[model samples]
Target: MSESFNWHKAVTKKWDQNVAFWSEKSRSMWNEGSRSGIIPFVKRYVPVGSQMADIGCGDGYGAFLLSEAGYDVTGVDISPKMIEHANQISGDRLIFKQGDLAELPFEQHTYDGLMAINSLEWTEDPKHALDELYRVLKPGGRLCIAVLGPTAGPRQNSYRRLYGEDVICNTMMPWEFEQLASETGWRTLDGYGVFKEGVKEDVSHMPKPLQQALTFLWVFMLEKQ
Candidate 1:
């Protein structure tokens, strides 16, 4: 079944269907929701006024935030509808384009930094996606990524793969991704977890494995070597 499944097409169609609702809440998400801290995190490592790309940039609101924060931002999403909505936003330094993660539509060494919030997991091949991301960044450029944690609801996208089905979601754990990044030439600069609301624990002081186990999302700031 996996051999015959077009995971890329399916994933794009799924996001296309969700464009309306996703675009509607995208701004709130970037401003003061679960995504509020992501741009700030990228800002911490990526210098202001840098050229950056936002992968899986739904509706491009997050890209807008990056531009507002002083970066020249380009938003890329696999879904055409998402790009259409993204194009509606007016910005002198923001660009929106429809493209795939596994095969990004840009020249090599083109960006100073990149952000891929909750984006890598949905790729048909996260490794290829990561490679493409690397290909686009100048040497020593920063990359900020947010991967859904073990208990994230979005993990359900890959659950059916247990039954020999194909899925866009790759079951890549936070620690596993860290290893992959290291092997692929990314130097981890910082790492942290974003937990769900309500319960609180000082996961920061705990081991990386323990912190990742209880997070809703695991964010990493890495440098391309």
Candidate 2:
């Protein structure tokens, strides 16, 4: 982290500028693309009608999916524009709020589960972000999270930091993120790799390490301990 850099400002600015693009693609993503599996995956552990908080919920599509799947949902994002776009869609069981991951605006033990897709890396402090997630969930609450793999193209946001530039994204690899989550008091219940279309293979028979090594993204199911 840079001492004088404004991380929150830069992150919000970046997402605000892309709200239109995100809104255009979010529906397909949650319905039939890379995120299609998340709702079902979470459903396996978090029962229907449970309260869920969707962190980094861009354009609210993922949160909509959660609501449609029968979970009462609240979607939160750092970018006001993203929240605005998310708010355009209304659901009896869903709502949107603008809030940062490191300091979510919610009471302790407020939710039964939380979902955060590609959000943790956007924070400057992964541990602190994880702690906040822990604080808001009830004991034994489920957490369904996804982190970009080592080769994911979206990780370019952190590339400029090598030359002394201040960047909002963190280059935390899948395994490293798992370790961090473990150290931060989350117990892993299950995890699997999500590869790009052409990269999918029968890696289920392989070792867990090898499976995640070839992923475009790794999704984990954890419980607050």
Candidate 3:
């Protein structure tokens, strides 16, 4: 499915209105781990002075972390509402733009690094998005992505099922992600899931029989051809 099935006005409207939900969720996960987790992970591949692009940078949370590390960061998202929130919070540290991932508005080989955390699944076409990502990145530039796993447990599965979202939603199992990277003109340097201490908070407060799906971090530090 190209997400066209669920790409009605109502869906986009709901996604836009859910900015608070996303912002709060990101704050607890990626933002909280910026210094101790994300920065260090980024430092492993992206160096100081590098120009980076963050696709689907929800509220620019991770972009802030990357900018603090001295990278010139630009955050792009499909939601203008999300971009507005990002501009308010990110200030001048990063540039936020309302744009689509599949049809990125940028020149070729313009960046030294690109980061997409948990946002890959949101793109209308993940493979095409990756192709665009590779095009805008310079040769040897790094592409870092973290996606969800297939067996993400009941908490995640239940909500997605209820919402009628894609189960293969934005997630790609380790091996599948690796294959995606290879086919997209990237050479993988590292890959794996970094599980946090617990399950998603949404499911945390839910009832029993709902096994909290352990959040798995599936990241790949890849280099462009």
> How does each model score on lDDT?
0.88, 0.91, 0.71
lDDT of 2 by residue, 124-221 (tens): 88899999999999999999999998667888988988898878888688899999988989999998787876675687899877777778789999
Q: What TM-score number comes out for model 3?
A: 0.79
Order of the predicted models by lDDT, top scorer first: 2, 1, 3
TM-score of each: 0.96, 0.96, 0.79
- How many backbone clashes are present in model 3? 3
| lDDT for position 165 in model 1 | 72
lDDT of 3 by residue, 1-225 (tens): 444565434335555887999788776676465223756777888888899988878778878878878889999887888888898865455899987777888999999999887767665567987899889999999988876654444125325645655443454566666788888778988654555555435544543223213345556688997
Clashes of each: 0, 0, 3
* lDDT digits (tens) for residues 1-225 of candidate 1: 557789889999889999988877887867887778887788789989999999999888889889999999999999999999889999999999999998899999999999999899888778888999999999999999988888778789889888887667776889999999999989999977878875375667788898898887889999999
Backbone clash tally for model 1? 0
| Model 3 ranges with Cα > 4 A deviation | 1-11, 31-36, 151-170, 196-215
In candidate 1, position 76 carries an lDDT of 98
Per-residue error for 59 in candidate 3, Å, reads 1.0
